[model samples]
Target: MSIKSEPHAGNLCNLQDRVAVVTGSSRGIGFEIARVLASQGCNIVLNGVSNESAIEAAAETLRQDYGVDVLCCFGDVSDASVTADMAKAVFKKFKRLDVLVNNAGILDDGLLGMMTQDQINRTLDINVKGPINTMQAFSRLLARSPSGSIINISSIIGREGNRGQVVYGASKAAVIGATYSAAKELAAQNIRVNSIAPGYIKTDMISAVPEDTHQERLDSIAMKRIGQAEDVARTALFLASDLSLYVTGQVIGVDGGMLI
Candidate 1:
């Protein structure tokens, strides 16, 4: 199922003509990751819960800014049908997929006892099941590429165990489990699987935190600052490129050593 790399042969970071499917990529960390990958000449697929027009606009930006082919798959990744349909479109357009970034996730903060079943289900569906669905749908396409990479976005809360984020933490932890299992199972296909656990990234989600609590987070980080989306995006670039061909079944922390 392997296709030789003609466009980017022997290049360390060049992803020219390669296809990347990034879930929840309309904005924030997902979009930045897709954008960085696009800068390296990869044909980009942007998936998100945003409306069709918004997602299309994001796609258009990539096409215009990087002159790379961009596809917008507007739908929630939690829906299996969406990933299936996106896979079909991607295979039809590019015939293969080199990288799949599972970046779609939600943060519903609440004590486990106070959380509604719907909240719990929604978080798990998007954060955990979404990656499962995308991996299943795109595995074949990815296996066909000479270099296949799966970068799953996890969070520090998954390992650090934050209060009021029990379910969110559990779901992210589950993602790490999936990464380990997939890396082992898919190694035979030369597909490298890894996870990134970001801590207090300055995104729309982080902006929602209370000012005092946000400062408290800043104090906890050795770097004494919040992270930017670009930080995670660049880490993803390394994983997606030949630079990390030998890396798999590992969880990289992009937390600015916040946990330390």
Candidate 2:
């Protein structure tokens, strides 16, 4: 799809001609982020893992609704080979990559004692290694852009640590650590790296929590309401746009003051 650039109407950040790749963006928070970025004039690459039809539908929606070019790239973010190919396709199609949102991750919640080795490895591979793989693969393309932004979607459990989220928390913490290191390394190239730690948002992932546990989580939030995907999406817009030029290597929480 081709979209001619239009005059931006308001003080919202203008991201014309920019290309963004949002992994695991077929639905949920990643999808909302992709939509918001497309609205801001970015050409979006909607990525998914083994879901060609879903990813293609998402791409089409962005193309029709926002009139922005949308590309569909499907593969597991944990595999370096897969991400390498994804990068090649992005560069082939867009010629430039301005933003990369490593939003692909998996959660296998269980007590450390009950968690099998396979479960632990799967969580770490997807939640931690996935972002690292994509970052390494896209670094060269991101370097070509005048400004590049990398947003890693983390979780509140990663920071505060819940009873059943031992391995998941560790993986998310690793993401923050990677963000700091990557930000320092990429600063010279004018590429910003940051992580967004979302609280108990109303996504399919959180729906797995038991009803009683879920209620307790809701009561703990300062806002007393579950966060919408758009809440986190707006923060991503700030980081992706020039508004956050000075911001890098930080973990912004979208958990409705639950961390406080």
RMSD in order of candidates: 4.6, 5.4
lDDT of 2 by residue, 7-100 (tens): 4544447788899999999999999999999998899998888778988988899899989999888889999999999999998999999999
Tens digits of lDDT, candidate 1, 38-77: 9999999998786678788889999999999998888888
Instruction: Report every candidate's CA lDDT.
Output: 0.92, 0.91
- Give the 10-residue window scoring lowest on summed lDDT in candidate 2: 6-15
* Lowest lDDT block of 10, candidate 1: 3-12
Query: Which whole-number lDDT from 0 to 100 does residue 253 have in model 2?
Result: 95
- For model 2, the stretches where C-alpha displacement exceeds 4 angstroms are 1-12
